[model samples]
Target: MTDFTGSMGYCEFQIPFFIEGVRVETSQMLVGTEYHEEAEKIDRETAIVMPLTKTKLQDKKEDLNFVREDIQTSFVQEFDFPECKATLSLFGRADKVVRKKETLIVSDDKHVSNPRRYDVMSEPYVGQLLQVLAYLNSKYYLGESFGGWKEIPCSTKMYQINIVDSKTRSIYKTYEEIITEEHAELFLDYTSKFIKKCLELDSLDHHNSKPKCKACGYFSDCSHALK
Candidate 1:
């Protein structure tokens, strides 16, 4: 259906290239001295797919043809993963509604701040986010409204949660079917380490990240490029 990769309120880039004059496409070769380096590179990718109907596919194509636009109205949903943990994540635009009008609460901090939670360099949270999404996909599909909230509350707090499974490996079945807890103890340890690693990476990214030019047309002023 509709294919998208988003950073929401962050660096969003799209590359459109013609497939012409290309008979084949392949990934780059990994370079490393140690055998473990090659092994690490093997886990660099995870594949996930969704079921789509003809109508949904057409709608997604229309949304993608010109530009990819994100949903402005925020939504929240509480998730109960396979691990028996109940947690929630926020979705929607930064400029969109923050506190729900009637209820007036910020139930999820991730929704209001709109930062990259699952950093590429982070340890556990990155994989955890993937694992959680994959688990959710197995049980249900993404719905239009916030599944967790009847009305977004007035005050919201932040809490971090991690998801892991040993039965699922990229080398085996697809991501959707693989998010299961086979080795809970080991997965928890690795994922926890990954979380701290990603936090440090986030701090570095914040300091070094640059804003777009002031003269750019897509943005109003350079000062507003998300500091």
Candidate 2:
């Protein structure tokens, strides 16, 4: 159980949210930089749930149409506008890739105790949509061994499989995201600005927002946090 506020590495998922959190935590070098051992326990627990969910999903893959798991992907490309000339290295791993005949469904599992609180169409889980699209847009984010994988599905759609704790309740069920080209393009545009903003960061810049603070692990030490 590693418990600490680690520095941000370039990750392909939830780019904006992670950037914002880092900016806040890094604002006051004196206080925020110190690692809060207790804060990361929740994150560790969350991470632990992933492998368990993946194992369960793996068992049902054939029936659920999952094609692959833990697929590694990386790419370097220049962006448009403010991010121009900057070659960003995007890297990530997709938890599962489901085959739906011709269209490929790239799915990432999000485990929560009370998943009913997060509606797929709401803002809370919107980042999941963005992250999953990154995997799909990068052509399923799979290695060359999956060369037979079709590109059409990659361009067309993706998914997010929300695994809620069924034992906690009677009606808790998993939700799925149906990502489209519009969703992908919107997130890509956001990524462009995200890259530019990240490059421009010198000192930590913090935002005055309540909801973000609630979700931030470093909020207790963040002097600029509203909460």
Candidate 3:
């Protein structure tokens, strides 16, 4: 197995969060130009969607940290759903790892037309979430540094905020922090791209309707509305 935490630093700005494919972005989060310098550039490029086709690692073994405590690795494989992709992160003290033979539960709704929603918040495995994130980080930064369409989840519980140039790295708040949905969905670069994607999908359906089929959600908003 590859040990990613040998001597390198922690992931810069990514937090632990999951994606439900569709994302949303607004103009309210356009601060901290320097903090999001790298991420902003990455946003323009096309993402090479990651394919974690492999199974999640099941580790029941315990690791003794420097704090003089035996911490057990209690998580087997992650669950895969049909409708939406889930990224789970579990916290708490567990004795050992546990892997459910059955696929973990996923959201039931397949027609998610909205953004800023996650399927794993209700129920998810922490181990699976970490594994998937590590995989994505490896693919995005370790091997070939680039962007892609693979949905990513991050937790910014432990992060180091730094900026190389002035105004490049400024701290941005979330909606909850700013008391508004617009701020909660701030564009910190990494998430900005996803939010932009969601906007594109929304705009396309609103403007150009290639087919006059009844399945279109924006049929009412389309130019050629059927009476």
Tell me the tens digit of each residue's lDDT in model 1 across 1-227: 00011121122221011112212111211111222243334423331223433343224222111011111232233433343433233233211122222222111111111123334433332333433332222222224443422232223212123221222311211111223354344434433333232232222122124443221232332233443
- Mark the 10 consecutive residues where model 1 has the least summed lDDT: 1-10
For each candidate in turn, the TM-score is 0.19, 0.56, 0.18
Better of 1 and 2 by TM-score: 2
Order of quality (TM-score):
2, 1, 3
Put down candidate 3 lDDT per residue, 1-227, tens digits, no spaces: 00111101112111111122222222322332222444435533534433322122222122211110112122222334343443322222211111123221110011122222432344222222323223222211111222332222222111111112223232221111111233223312223333233333212122232452233333343345443
The numbered model that scores best in lDDT is 2
Give the Å shift of residue 137 in candidate 2. 0.9
* Better TM-score candidate (1, 3): 1
Model 2 scores worst on lDDT over the 10 consecutive residues at: 1-10
lDDT of each: 0.25, 0.46, 0.24
lDDT of 2 by residue, 56-119 (tens): 3324232234333445544345765642467666566666655553455765554444565665
Q: How much does candidate 1 score in TM-score? A: 0.19
